[model samples]
Target: MDSNKNTAVISVIGKDRVGIIAGVATLLSQNDININDISQTILDGIFTMIMMVDLKDNVIENSDIVEKLNALGEELGVTITIQHTDLFDRMHRI
Candidate 1:
């Protein structure tokens, strides 16, 4: 765990099913990724979840998180994405 706090967003989309949140959360916990905030909902059987995570303590590279999530997405039949909050905020800034 590092001292400098870094932030990122993890987004998930998929057919509504069980264990989606649990699986993702478990992985983050295992990897020492801290969840700062989360929003999740299921609409018309489509599941969507967004997790804002703190990576300050995590030593794993962002690329590793992305790859693991991509593989997890395949296993769970979902689309998973991760992007730094700084870039996300910049892109959406008006």
Candidate 2:
């Protein structure tokens, strides 16, 4: 792995439904983002997923990933977020 590669912590949350995984995975694949780790489950019809992805080879910037995910989330009736690893770690440290 390249040390310069950026990593993003991504989370998806909402009521369970079809196409969430396909939508997210397709977008990531299209952008050259690789999912390094992932966990997903549903409870009482609510869907939740957390993923760590390497964005070093991304075709777009980190901010654009956030925007695209947000838009996709809206279409899917879910909440999708992408945060850079540095910021994610700092935010969790408190």
Instruction: Please list the residue runs of candidate 1 whose C-alpha ends up more than 4 Å from where it truly belongs after superposition.
Output: 1-5, 57-63
The sequence of per-residue lDDT tens digits that candidate 2 reaches over residues 15-87 is: 8888998999999998788999999999788899999999875644634777889999999999998877777
CA lDDT of each candidate?
0.84, 0.84
**Residues 1-94 of candidate 1: C-alpha lDDT, one tens digit per residue:** 2223478899999997779899999989888888999999988889999999997755446348888999999999999998777776667775
Query: Model 2 reaches what TM-score against the true structure?
Result: 0.81
Q: Which candidate is the best by TM-score?
A: 1
The RMSD of every model to the true structure, in order and in angstroms, is 3.6, 3.4
Clash number for every model? 0, 0
